[model samples]
Target: YCEKFCVFVVSMDRSFLPETPVPSSLSRRIGGGHWDKPYNRGSLMLRAEISTVGDSQEVSSIHSGQSRLTTVGDRLMDSKCKCGAKEQLILCKSRLEHLVGDDRKRRRCAVNRGKLAAAGQAALRILSDDLLAAVTEAEAEMKACAARIIQEELVAGQLRESEIGIVERGCALGALRDKVASLRAIEKASQEKLRRHVDRREAERGSVLEQLHSRLAVCNELRATLTAIKSRLSLMRHRVRSRQDSLEVARSDMEVYRKVLDEVPAIMVDLANGERETLQRREELERRAMALSEEMKEIDTQIASVTNSRAQEVGGRKRCLEREGKELDQLAQRLDAMQEYVGDCQQRRMSGSSRL
Candidate 1:
């Protein structure tokens, strides 16, 4: 009757026990749990609502432990007794193999699960013996003593688990504190690096901008120089055209002079009217033709000088164009490199922020 009443009371307690939130995968992975470590033992008791349908919440004691008080009570109401710790361990190993499908993971779970199964079996044994005592009254005194001894052991186990839990958590907390400190240091370093990069980028941009301005100025000067060269070339072309027209006029004059010379001989023979006046007119025409020929020679020399100057100006402009193209290409390459660098910095900033 006492055992049954105790079982009833434990069920009632479990019914009202609060549930704890599960941890996330990332935290669990980083937690670095050891199978023998206390925190990994799970909660003091697995209180399922299904097992204690009518039970409700009440206060629990710190010293007695849920394991000592409730192990038998909880298990008596269970559908079937799970096998002993060793068998459960085998079962856990099989589960690890079947579910994990990896040697390392299975090994990790096996280590943890093996300890868990042992604790569970120890718990189950207490419950099984309790039920056995309830059904059979033989050796009641011995069983009672055994029950008290088991309860004490269970309570001590629970206390050890609790203490280990606190210690492990303290260790974990310390680790986390150290990590936070380290992260802060890294963050400071990165921020400083980023600031330096920003300063460097600013200086580079300013220099590049100044260079661009200078290039623009040079380009403007070059344009003005080219315009001046064009004007000079146009003037030269006009002079050459005018000289060509003068040369044509001189040739026509020479042809007229030759015809006049031919007629002079003819006139002398015929003894025509006013022969002295005709000879005077012919000499004046010869002098005019000679003057035209000298003018033609001067025009040809001026044309040659103008053409040479034009060729020199064109060559100079070609050289300038080639130099300007090379400068522009260098600037373009620098611009591309700067753009790529800026992009990489932005990407790093994004990745760092996401990690935080």
Candidate 2:
């Protein structure tokens, strides 16, 4: 009686207990097998419910110790009890395959014939109630599981969205960084170009300034040269004025000389006439002198012959002839004096002509 009581109490407790989650091993086995298929979930739920019902009925039967209470519940439990885990799984599969078809046929036949005994009707109603309760529990479990899955999916979706946003922001930051770097490089290049241009312009400006300074110095030199030229030109102008004065004096002297020269031509003609007359007289005198020289030469030759002849005959007459010879020498001297007077006259005439 104690054993029966204990079994009855355990069965009652099991029936009244809140449904627990499936064991990890049993669920893993089911999940690892064909139960992994989504379409088998309903069958799995039905099998679980049927197994619970069978276990409860088996416990109750052990308490009652009666075979007469044996029904579908005992049959299911007996089939399960006779097998190991794999066989039990196969039996559960076969029962699940026939459950829907058999229930439908039995309900249809009972309704059509109206031949069901009260006990059978009552058992059917009880089974129907149990099936409905199991279905409701399974539906509730499915709804809770679906809600949990949806919540998990929502959390996973949020995490994925955050990750995607982070990735997109990182990509944007990288692009922005690259753009900034490019902009900096461009700025640097532009700055360098500007600096070079400025330096070039500065060099050009400096060169221009230097050129301007050199040109200014050149201009100063030119100004100094111009001043010196002006001074030299003034000096030259003064010298030209003096030269003009000298040229005017020379012109006046030349005019006086021209008048004197015009008057001197008549004087020159008169002198020429006098010179011609003097030349005739001098020629006549030269002829006379030449005749006298010939006569003196003949006299000298005759005296020489007389002296030779008288040398023997006239010694006393020779003294008298010497006195006569002295007289003749005095006459020759007189003729030479006359010749010198003519030569002096000719020289005076030449001097007078030259003066003219």
Candidate 3:
């Protein structure tokens, strides 16, 4: 019984027990129900033994008849009491009773409460931290997505602007090309017209050159004829001087004959015959002088007519030469204008080529 009781106490307080087993008498008392009544003397002694093993409430409730037993056991244990008594056993028993009261009903309740409280607090802290981190991460992701969307929109707008610029430049270049083609066509037409005008001018110049050559030849022939007429007129004036000198010599000789006839006169032979012969001689001499004067006047009139005709021919030739000169000047002006127009066209062509 004592060994059984010791084993039960050892099991209950294993954290405080030593390596040794309990006494055999205590083991037997623990196993038997004969120790069930607290007032029985054998049971009271058993309670005392149980109190030494820390079963305090059982010892306190035992019979008062066992007080001496308890006191003797206290002395044998040699322990001090709180009441200034040398009663180690009694003090140990009273301490065990106090510890085994209704307060010790559930032995592991307090420790379990502490562990559960700690676990709950740690779980609450972890959950709060995780929630805050999730909220922050979600906000950051939303901001990044918004920024990317804005960048894409900006790039799209720039692309649209570039496309518009390209289209406008293409349109402008096309218009310029059309204008250039029109100008080239107009220039080609003008060149054709200019060529025709030059050809016509050359034909007219050739005709005028031929006419001038013919007029020059006629003028030279007229000059030669006028020189021959002037030589003939000089010879005729020399012959008229010789004739005047011969007439004067004849008159002097006839006067001398008249003087000789006067000296032998006074005899009257035939008066009517002498007077008729003298009158016939005077009429004949007067007729010869009058014919010579009339011939000289006719010659002077012919010479004047020839001089007027020569002057008219010379004046006509001079007038024609002046007209020809004026025509040549006009032709020169036309040629100069054509040259200037050609130069302008060449310059325009060069400029157009540079632009291309």
**lDDT of each model, Cα atoms only?**
0.49, 0.51, 0.47
What is the full ranking by TM-score, best candidate first? 3, 2, 1
- Clashes per prediction? 0, 0, 14
RMSD of each: 44.8, 75.2, 46.9
Residue 340's lDDT in candidate 3: 66
Candidate 1 residue spans exceeding 4 A from truth: 1-150, 234-356
The most accurate candidate by TM-score is 3
In terms of lDDT, the poorest run of 10 residues in model 1 is 25-34
The estimated TM-scores of all candidates read 0.24, 0.26, 0.30
Tens digit of lDDT per residue, candidate 2, span 94-204?
A: 554365455556446534423323333454455556556655755665576567557656756765775586567557656766765675676567557656855775675
Error of 3 at 207 (Å): 4.9
Q: Write candidate 3's Cα lDDT for 38-60 as tens digits.
A: 22222333343454544343344
- Cα RMSD of predicted structure 1: 44.8
Candidate 1: tens digits of C-alpha lDDT, residues 195-255: 6755775675566557556655655665575576467767677665766677466557556
Backbone steric clashes in candidate 2, count: 0
Q: How accurate is candidate 2 locally (lDDT)?
A: 0.51
